[model samples]
Target: MTVTAESALAGVQRIIATYAQNIDAGNTDVVADLFTEDGVAEIEGQDTFEGRETIRKVYGQFSPQTPQLHLVGNTVLTSEPGEEVTATSNLVFFARGEEGWGIQLVGTYEDTAVLVDGEWKFRRRVTKFL
Candidate 1:
């Protein structure tokens, strides 16, 4: 109802939108930019990646490799307060390559969003393989 709450919600929306941008455009920088200077991305069966640099490399690996499309919906949980926000949702991703435009992966985005310079960004996230 307050400005902070609205900003926080907007930030959450941005984070989720960025996920779509990252996969569709292969722009990992946008993905990492969703986070702060010190951000973490934890994927299953992989060690946690600390900071944006590691995130860049990881995105590079994914971008060049997979023809991907990430469709995210159904926010199951969310937290607020402009400086801190978190959202959990089901992300249905589609991919194309050898298979050509079929369902690729179904997963969840556990996002930790933070506000910096009055703009919200993701401080960390766990891309849970489900």
Candidate 2:
């Protein structure tokens, strides 16, 4: 299949969306697979996780007691088609707890993604809380 710039951009967007969906649904188990074998995840104020196994384990720790939702938007991508792309997006985290539903966090995601075996996967994803 030919990869046009538009198609590559769309694929990268899908990867970002999928990550948010999986996290909000507490499906961290599959989240690691969205990344490269040696991909890195760095969440501000937390330990940096590298490699799929380590990333998986770190995400496993986020078993939220209440249902959560992640809203990701305003993605800006840089880089040529079929090459590693860097993207930045805003994040708004919501959750329902004893206090009722509310916004829990506001952040931004800075990501570097690459096409691997015909699929886009994250090479590095950084979360900065604000």
TM-score of 1: 0.85
lDDT, model 1: 0.76
TM-score list, all predictions: 0.85, 0.92
Residue 45 CA error for candidate 1 (Å)? Answer: 1.7
State the local distance difference test value for candidate 2.
0.88
Model 2, range 8-72, lDDT digits (tens) per residue? Answer: 77887899999889987878877999999999999999868999999999898896778999899
- Cα shift from native, residue 123, model 2 (Å): 0.4
**Candidate lDDT values, in order:** 0.76, 0.88
lDDT of 1 at 74: 74
The segments of candidate 1 whose C-alpha lies over 4 angstroms from its true place after superposition are 1-4
